[model samples]
Every structure is written in structure tokens, then in C-alpha cells.
Target: MLCFGFTFLYVPMVLLIVYSFNYSKIVPVWGGWSTRWYTVLFESEEVWAAITLSLKIALMNATFATMLGALAGLALVRFKSFRGRTLFGGMISAPLVMPEVITGLSLLLLFITLGQLIGWPTNRGITTITIAHITFSMAYVAVIIQSRLTGLDQSLEEAAEDLGAKPFRVLIDITLPLLAPGLLAGWLLAFTLSIDDLVIASFVSGPGANTLPMLIYSRVRLGLRPDINAMATIIIIVVAIGVCLAGWLMMRQERQRQRDMQLASGDNIKQD
Candidate 1:
């Protein structure tokens, strides 16, 4: 069953990667194995521009989402009793359940209203798209962070406070470091969602603000081409590399944490 599931998921991607090197212009008809489409993709200015724009938006969205989501998570976890806490928590999680079309429509209206009132963001482009991505992406980040905080041992933080550390100092020294894995995971999730988004981006973007997904969708509408296959292959390779790197870092951190715990246990045994 596991092998069947893996095959179901990755077989299409494998086929797409294989056909990216086809010499034929038609996507389905493989003339012969060649790197012609890759060269064409590299030389296309429009594709490159879209790729650049998408990456910029994804990076900004991930960063802002991580920061805001971390703060929200801290608020929900750390502050036990606060006025309107339920309302605030509900708002933070709303985007997760909301439909993308509705979210996009609401944000579009918001930008339009803001423009009319304050004359800010007169045109919707990267700025608007980044904001839109962050809105929905942060919800996922917040959930991850909240779960992480919930499972974390609070004794270390209490000990820090007992040792004369300020609240902020304890957070900086104890909480944030413990939250690093969660933060990294949230950031990567946000980045991937932003890059993969099309519905929200389409609603928020203006002229000449095409993202890679937008460009790909438009091209696919016309017809599939060998270059499109090549682009997908490149994206798959980059994402695979990123996932592997993140996994390695996470494993290394976990090993170090286990070692520290063992050493602490040994010292306690000696003292006893």
C-alpha cells in the first residue's frame, strides 16, 4: 500500500522530468532525448522575470508570516486570560478555514478601499500579492507554532524567571531557541504555499505582476509545451534539494538535543 501510494504520487512527476529532455516541441510526442527545451527555458526573459517575482514574494511572505504567526502563537499560549482572547484566536485561525476565492475577494476589496481612503498601494502588484500570501500563510504558521508551544516543557522558562531573568530575556534565551524547529517548518510551508498560489495571487496582482504559477497556468491554457515540462522539472529539483537540506538540519538538531539531555541525566546521577 505504501509503495502504491508513493507510485501514485510520484509517477507523474517522474514522467514529466523524463519528457522535459524531449527534442520535440509537442509535449506528449517524444522525438528524442535532448536538452533543447531547457536551453529555451533558460533564455526566456518572461519566464525568468516571473520566477524572480515569485521568489521575492515567497521570501517576503514567509518572513512576515513567521514573525506575525510567532507573536500570535505566543499570545495564545503565554497569556492565559486576556480580554477578547477568543475573538483574537478565532480571527487568527479564520484564514485557515476560509476559501481562497473569498479571501482573495475580501483582500481585493480591502486594498481598493485602502487605496481610496489613504492613497496607499495605488496599484496592486508584488506588495499586494505578498500581503495576500502572508494573510493565509500565517494561519498555518500560527497553528504549527501553537502546537509546538503547547508540547514544549515550560520548566526551563520558569527556572529562567526564578534565576532573575526578565520575561523578554527568558523568551529570547529559552523559548525562541526551543521554537526554532517549528519556526523553520512554518517558514518553509509559507514559502511553498506562496510559490504555489494562483487564485489569491491572480485576484491581487495587477499588470506585469505575473508569478511563476500564473505564468505556467497561462501557458498551459494555450497548450502544453516541452519548455513547460522543463520548468516543472527544475522546480521539482529545487524543492527536492530544499526538503533534503531542511531534513538534515532538523535531524542534526534532534541528535544534539538528545545528547544534551543524556549529559544532563549523567550529571544529575553523579550529584545524587
Candidate 2:
């Protein structure tokens, strides 16, 4: 059942990729295969501009979301008994559960209100889209980091303190190293979400704020374009490669940690 489910989900994407090289723009048809569409995609300045904008927003959103989420995760995990903790956690995660349309509308209203009151974010553009992306992205990031924090060995932190390391130094040297994998995972997820966003971005984005997805959406609505297929194929390949790389890195890190533990145990036995 699980395999069937996975296959069902991926088959359409696989078909799309296969059809990307098809010479017939009508799709699901075979004409003599050609890479011409990819060539066109590379040469299109408009497409390139959208891609650049998306990448920039994704990078910035990921950085800010990851940092904010990490701090929130720490607070939630380490200080569970704080006043209004429940309300705070609920507020942090509200965006994730809210409908995209609702979230977008709310953000737009907030932007309007802020503009009238404070004169910031004067008009929607990259900043508005990025803020919306970060709003949701950070919720997922916080959840990931909090899960990792919950599973971490608290004794390691205590040992750092016993060794005369200050609290901040212990956090930097001990906690941060152990949490590196979680942070990296959270950052990657946040980046991917930001890059692929559409609905919220659509509502928040103003004139001249089209992202790659928005550009694609506009072109797709007109009719099938071979260039779109080529772009989709490239994105699928890139996403697959990234997933494989992340899995490999995580496995390698886990193996190294286990080996270190074994070596430490061996040294302790020898000293005894």
C-alpha cells in the first residue's frame, strides 16, 4: 500500500519529465525528441529574472526562519513552564494550520495596517513575499528543531558546564554542534518551501514581484509550453539530488558520532 501510494504520487511527475523532451508540445505525445526547449529556457531573460528573484527570497527567508525557529525551539524545549507557553506555541504554529488564502489575506491586511501606522513595507514586493514564506517556514523549522532538542542528551551540556564553560559558550560549542544536523535539515526545508511557494506569494506579491512559480503559473495558464516541461524536469532532478545528498550527509554524521562514542568508551576502559 505504501509503495503503491508513493508510486501514484510520483508517476505524474515522472511522466511530466519524460514528456519534457517530447517534441510535441501537446504533451503525452511522442514526436522526435529534442533538447530545444531547455535551450530556450536558458536564453529567456524573463525566466532567468524570476529564477533569480525566487532564489534570493528563498535564501534570505531560510536564514531568518532557521535562526528564529532555533531560538523558539530552545525556549519551548528548555523552558516548558513559562507563563502563557501554550498560547505562544499556538501563535507560532497558527500559520501552518491556517488556509493559505486566509494566511495571505491576513498578511496583506497586516501589511496595509503597518504601512498606514509605521510607513514600513510601503508597497508589497520581495519583502512581503519573503515575510509570508518565513511566517510558515519557521513553524515547520521550530517543530523540527524542537523534536531534535527533545531527543538530545542533556548530560553533555552539564558536562560542558562542569568543565567551566559559560552558558553561552556551552550552547555554542556543545549544543550547537549536536544540533547542527537538525538546523541544516530545517534550513533546507525552509528554502525549498520558499522557492516553491505560490498561493501566499501571489496574494502578497505586488507588481514586478513575480517569482519563478508565479511566472510558470502565468505561462502555464496560457497553454502547454515545452519550456515549462524542461524547467520542471530540471527542478525534479535538482530536488532528487538534494534529497540524496541530505540523506547521505545525515547517515555519515550519525556514523561518525557512534564511532566517537565507541572510541571514548574504549579510552575509559583503558584508563580504568
Measured by TM-score, the strongest candidate is 1
Q: Per-residue lDDT for 1-272 in model 1, tens only?
A: 99999998999999999999999888888799899989999999999999999999999999999999999999999898899999999999999989999999999999999999999889999999999999999999999999999999989899999999999999999999999989989998999999999999999999999999999999999988889999999989998998898789879999999999999999999999
Candidate 2 residue runs with Cα over 4 Å from true position = 1-7, 251-272
Which residue pairs show backbone clashes in model 1? none
For this target, which candidate reaches the highest lDDT against the unseen true structure?
1
Name the TM-score of candidate 2: 0.89
TM-score of 1: 0.91
Instruction: Give candidate 1 misplaced runs (Cα > 4 Å).
Output: 1-4, 251-272
Instruction: Report lDDT (CA) for all predictions.
Output: 0.95, 0.92
Ten-residue region with minimum lDDT total, candidate 2: 23-32
RMSD of each: 2.2, 2.6
lDDT (Cα, 0-100) at 78 in candidate 1: 86
